[model samples]
Target: MTAFLLRKLGWAAATMLTVSILVYLALEVNVDDVAAKVLGQFSTGEQREAWLLANGYRDPLVLRYGRWLVAFLSGDWGLSSHFRAPVIEIIPARLGASLLLGACALLVMVPTALLLGVIAGMRPNSVMDRVVSVFAILSTSVPDFASAVLLSAIFVFWLGVLPGTSTMLTGFSLSELVLPVAVLALYSTGYLARITRTAMAEVMASHYVRTARLKGAGTFRIVFRHALRNALIVPATVVMMQVPWLLSGVIVVEVFFAYKGFGSLLYDAALNSDIYLIEACAMVSVVVVVLSQILSDLAYVWLNPRISLSGAERSAGVTDA
Candidate 1:
């Protein structure tokens, strides 16, 4: 376990380094006169040149990348030109908000998807299964933005029961979160449900389940105690992989709902050419993606003791020899 974690952590660092370099280069190539933009156009040529030199923007690309990487490692993410504040200061609250929203959506999505999937899988080809399959297909087919708009219109405009925008001044309230959460839940629930249903159905058809049935195991015990544990292996990984998507791919929903979260911050930063903020957001996304995969791997290992770690696999081979 220790060796596996160390190896994963090493890979994570390498991944982050590569991502940071690519993001930095992409921004540097696309945005001309970054120093002028950062120092302001009204500043004289000498001022811009001096600012660029002082910031090492005048250095070679490799040197500049190394400088930025070092600073990033030391928790100095640089200043946000958009907000006239440090990137560190601006991002934490936005990140927290995005995480909170994602958590709220997941809280609603997971159980609902699992319950519907279990029912459908256990009664394959029946009315309940067909209905769930249809709902899953329909929900997944709809674009997230369209789903957000439709939900917002129905709840905020037509019914007038919920707020149209999620922007909150005195922190968040359940009422303010209803439409946004509903949109996210609806968008993500379908994919999770489909995966769960497929896994559960496959597990239910396996020989062990047949043996259990032949052994006169109760339906509930066979399904819950035996099938569900193995079925969850795939779905657990699927759910973990959604973390990066929820963090970075919710831009449309955030913009539509006026939610002040990481997605919105990234959108605004890119639009305004806030290079530091954009880089920071990209790093956050990369980190989340890598970490979530690692987490998923760990969860799979924990859920199935029969699964061998790299070290353990080598040990088993030696023992066999």
Candidate 2:
């Protein structure tokens, strides 16, 4: 397990480094002059040149990349052109909001999906199963923005149950997050439900489940202990994969709700051509994705003993011996 963890950590580090370089390069390509972007178009040629030279933007691409890399390593993410603040400072505040929203979405999505899916899987061809299947399909098929709009219209406009906008004044609170969280959760629930249902159905039909049933095990024991554990293995992986998707894909939802999360920050940075801010957002996103994948891989190994065993262990006749 120690060796496995180390390997995963090493891969995550490599992925983060590669993603950072790519993000930096991508951000660099979008801007003609970072200093000009900061100073505005009204600045004269000499003024622009001086600003560029002073900020080291006039240096070669490699040199600039190297300098940026060193600063990033030392925890200085540079200044945001749009916000007129340090990238490091601005990112965390936004990230906190995003994290809260994401957590709330996950909290709602997991149980709802699991319950619906398990019921569908257990019943197979019942009316409840069909209803769940149709709902799952619709949930996964509809785009997030459309869902957000529809939800906002229904809940905020007509019902007045939840707030339309996610703009919080002093500090973060649950009320401020409700709409955004619901939007993301509702959109994601369908995918998770379908995956869980499929996994559970497969587990229910397995030989071990048949054996457990034949042994006269109680229905709850057979389903929960024998079946659900195996079924959850795959769904858990799918759930973990959603982390990166939530981090980046929430941009449209955030924009619609006027939520100032990482996704919104990223969208603003891109629209304003704030390369440093964009790069920071992209790098942070990449880190989140890589770490989530690592967690997924570890969970996979934990669920499947065959995967947990070392290659040498499998090759040797250890089990036979």
Write one digit per residue (lDDT tens) for candidate 1, span 256-314: 88999989999999888788898899998898888887887787767667887774435
**For model 1, which pairs clash?**
none
Query: Candidate 2 — which residues are off by over 4 angstroms?
Result: 29-32, 309-321
**TM-score per candidate, chains pooled:** 0.93, 0.91
CA-lDDT, candidates in order: 0.83, 0.81
Off by over 4 Å in 1: 29-32, 311-321
Among these predicted structures, which one has the highest lDDT?
1
> By summed lDDT, which 10 consecutive residues of candidate 1 come out lowest?
311-320
